[model samples]
Target: SQQGEEDPQALSIQEGENATMNCSYKTSINNLQWYRQNSGRGLVHLILIRSNEREKHSGRLRVTLDTSKKSSSLLITASRAADTASYFCATPGTGGFKTIFGAGTRLFVKA
Candidate 1:
């Protein structure tokens, strides 16, 4: 499967702490994207790293890609209670418009 799966389906942390998640896939992909969704809100794009890229960072979030192993990781530093939400990893489909989302890692950041 070209789709990837994330470890630790759930996570809980105190405000100001860091959270890390890992993902693994079975096949090659064009790029991988991280998204955040709050409760009922729509998924918000966090970052997108192409296959050739090794690492990327944005604000308090850091993402790393290892195409040789077909895996990736996302790390969020200094998390806030407002950061409490479900995070997902997606890989664009062959058709481009389609992307496959994993079950997601629900993160709860307590104040």
Candidate 2:
């Protein structure tokens, strides 16, 4: 059972613009994380925002959490063609030490 579910199933943006993706979950979570995956490759951890934290930033990525709403968002600034990939939200759940991922948002940054 996937813990998080992402919105806007797909996205297309011009390079240098910003891309934002959202996730919503069901159940109480201790932490939420965002990840990026290039085609035919493994996911790369982008950022982790805890339930107690509202916002966090790393490089061009910004993550925000609102446990009250069971929602989170990831913002990527100055997007590039290289940023073309699928983004997913993850949560560790009762799935027995497994992390479940939401249906990803496929982003295409047009050059």
Candidate 3:
């Protein structure tokens, strides 16, 4: 019901398979960012794709944004057991001083 809500709250995949997660937000944002956090660890910035850009990639990660639909998706290719973590999608809040994060998707990569 709130902004930056992610779907498929949990996912399990075997090593070497691709994992996908989706997030939907309600607002006009200049950019969207994705982050990964391991259990008991800090969040790591993954990627920040702008509103004007449709797609961006970093390493084995791919991010796609659709301003029209106010949605974004993250794809991890060739997932490894080490990649098991919680992924979150973030967007800047009013005045750009705050960041709203989605509930996050928990990924379990089995070896």
Candidate 4:
């Protein structure tokens, strides 16, 4: 089964600062993905890091995966008010057909 849990259910940061979110899983995973969801909107894929990869970057977003520890972290640089959203981590379940999502971390950026 796919099981991922994100820590710090809520976070508040100021604009121009950095925001960090973490995820921990119970079982081995081939890959992990991070997503952001705006209020009343869809979840936007932020980054994906494979089991063999330690760190990946996209734009201002950085993701690190540690298979040994079964954990991952996402860092958003230069936070903005518009970046306020709920962030989630996902991993494929058994058979690689199901995607399980974490409880998500609600982030609020103050301008």
Residues 2-111, model 1: lDDT tens digits: 38788779999999999998888777898999999999899999999999999999999999999999889999999999999999999876777889987788999999
lDDT of 3 by residue, 13-45 (tens): 999999999999999999999999999999999
Which residue pairs in model 2 clash with each other? none
TM-score of each: 0.94, 0.96, 0.97, 0.97
Q: Provide the overall lDDT of each model, using Cα atoms, as 2-decimal numbers.
A: 0.91, 0.94, 0.96, 0.95
State residue 35's C-alpha deviation in candidate 1, in Å: 0.5
What range of 10 consecutive residues in model 2 has the weakest lDDT sum? 91-100
TM-score of 1: 0.94
Against the hidden true structure, what lDDT does model 2 obtain? 0.94
What is the Cα-based lDDT of residue 7 in candidate 1?
77
Q: Write the per-residue lDDT of candidate 2 for residues 1-111, one digit (tens) a residue.
A: 777899989999999999999999999998998999999999999899888999999999999999999999999999999999999999987855878899999999999
Q: What is the lDDT of residue 32 in candidate 2?
A: 92
Clashes of each: 0, 0, 0, 0
Q: Return the TM-score for candidate 2, rounded to 2 decimals.
A: 0.96
Candidate number of the best lDDT:
3
CA error at residue 77 for candidate 3, angstroms? 0.3
